[model samples]
Target: MVPMRTIAHCDLLPDLIQQLLESNSDTHLIVCATRPEFLLHLTAAIRSQRADPDTAASHDLLTKTIGLLARSSKIRLAFCPTLESLRAYLAVLGANSNESTEEIRSRDRQLLSILDMVAMHVTTSEFSAQGLSRTLASAVEAAYSAGMDLRLYECTNALDPSSAVWGRKLWDMSVPSLNGSVRMRGDESTWGGRGVTVKRVAERWFEFDHSH
Candidate 1:
């Protein structure tokens, strides 16, 4: 029997996994602050491999990535944004019907579990965001509590009727900023009503801003 040697590359994945899992409040603050850049990285990574067939190596990579995300302190803070990314990846898989159904289903189950955990955290925690405004406000509060100073700016176009309706409701709830400057035009007006403009769901962004 020969002794097994650990190479640097062999340790890389595990090290990354540990770091992500052991992420602290400070880590969450950083994630909240640089969410856009983080998301862009995630998107590019996904797009780069979108055409690759699901293999054992690919599955392992995804599993490790998801595990890291699950254990990260930023999990709750970045839940929605992360979910959107996951949804995009899953959409790619879904579009490729050639893949094994069993494999796809298994991956879907795992993703759904992660999503459920996020929803549960939001529901159980004292940190709550009612609508877009409250959501941004809570994010800022969370970041500040974590001792991070960051600013976020968001511009959303509510083209979908469903999204516009919900956006309007969120606006009324005071969770979203209705500064009365952002306006909806053209076919978008049919979403809520004729001449009933939509407001910017988020003027100030960031899962958590430093200012309370």
Candidate 2:
């Protein structure tokens, strides 16, 4: 099996998957958490660059090869930049309470770094919104004590885990707290509650569903 570091050959991803997953294969292929999703983005960029060699996008694409450069660079790092990527990594832990229902739950630590990176980019509007609570909460329930910095994000004032709205354990999100400030709150030791739902609620929103 060829170890294509960045998955640059987007078209070859299918074969790569087959080779890695086939029982008869003698080799293995490993990819970072973001590679699968980012591969789509990279493919688009490559296609755009190739479709019009004379276009300005083509000329600029030469130096702005996000996939080739960033994939290699980001994979080596610990954090992720977007909420989607963060959620995706967290989902990697397991669908429910991160109990390691399957072998996939073992990657919780790596998922933590993605949260840390997402928290850094998260804002008050996002933190307070009803959409992100469950996923953030699920991640909290996984290993709150170990991932304090990853759950709470502050755009202005410092995040207070004790008093922040997120601290209320507002699963239904019925509480209307005047303090718009957002912070990570809830039981951290175990993923006992409903935790984050892996189901897709919207393009970027994932709601918590206990059944999952």
Candidate 3:
């Protein structure tokens, strides 16, 4: 199986891109970001590096890489918003004193726009039932509108009442797999059932699918 490589930081992107271009066309890549503004940060990083004469060539390469990644059929342009990441962002934003509210809001808007433009699969995250449902449903609707596939989700094992409902809903939607579950921290009761399937993809990365 082809391993799904994650870009946890912007600095790691260039090397990952090179590997993808040089390796088999079936490489799966995901931007595992806790912040919604990760793409903006990535762009900023690229621009800052491009200003330096030494790294200018890399900037051009990164641009080309982004283009290829966007259009490649063999590559998956997936984004994992990360479990509770959205909520954490909200909390941090509320407390952050460095930026004004309007500035932050504008930045967030840009992040969402960038995400819509580049992401093929976006994993939903959050612990609240309402938040989980909203994010998952919104991502699904967005993917459908963009003619993309909804195949990834952040993992959870202990399904509180609400999470269980969300999981059942996902099963009903026929989503093929989830992104993380191997490191699930609580009861496993809700995850095991007659028709459910769990497969380990990597450390902390598990797939939960239902029998169709």
Candidate 4:
């Protein structure tokens, strides 16, 4: 079995990828770092690395590198970012894309897989009737469209009327399957006991059946 590789600096990503591609044996990579948010900074850094044609060339190179990672069978790559960092990254991704429809779809398909791998790490108490919650819900909806197997983490807040409306909102969502587990600091009965079968996975974490 190949040992999982871990790296600290974002500048090392391309080098790691090159090594993985060159290796004769299969491997799964897990690039651990104290500051996972550096990924967003890396994106910005790559863009500003040059101007005009050079910037465009670097952008294409970055895009192709990601595409290569996704397609390579010899190397399985995965990373888990905090919910906040993931949200920021997803927002950047959802922004205007100049690529073709096919290219966009292909990228989304690859992204959907990565999203699935990190779905459980997505913690949110933004279930309250707020614009931000709605924005996050919209992102979730888009992920569903891209064929993501989302296992969400709802950090239910007892004092907040979060689960009240959001539970109903989730129930009304049009998707093939909506399944998630909740990490509760307080009683989640305000929503969990409402026609949902809750199976305890661990302390404070309960898995709910597929709502759709």
RMSD of each: 18.4, 16.9, 15.7, 16.0
lDDT of each: 0.30, 0.32, 0.35, 0.35
| Candidate 2, 50-111: lDDT as tens digits | 65656534343344455444333322233344556555655554343433334333333332
Please give the clash total of every predicted structure, in order. 7, 1, 0, 0
> Residue pairs in steric clash, candidate 2?
197-208
Can you give the lDDT of residue 181 in candidate 1? 24
lDDT of 3 by residue, 40-147 (tens): 544554565577777867544555766565545555554446544433433343344365545534432211111211121223322223333444444344333332
- Please give each candidate's TM-score: 0.26, 0.24, 0.31, 0.28
Off by over 4 Å in 3: 1-10, 34-36, 58-60, 63-71, 84-212
Model 1 ranges off by over 4 Å: 1-60, 63-130, 149-190, 193-200, 206-212
Instruction: Output the lDDT of residue 89, model 2.
Output: 53
Residue-pair clash count for candidate 3: 0
Q: Which residue runs does candidate 4 get wrong by more than 4 Å?
A: 1-81, 102-111, 114-124, 127-212
| Per-residue error (Å), model 2, residue 132 | 4.4
Error of 3 at 59 (Å): 5.1
Better of 3 and 4 by TM-score: 3
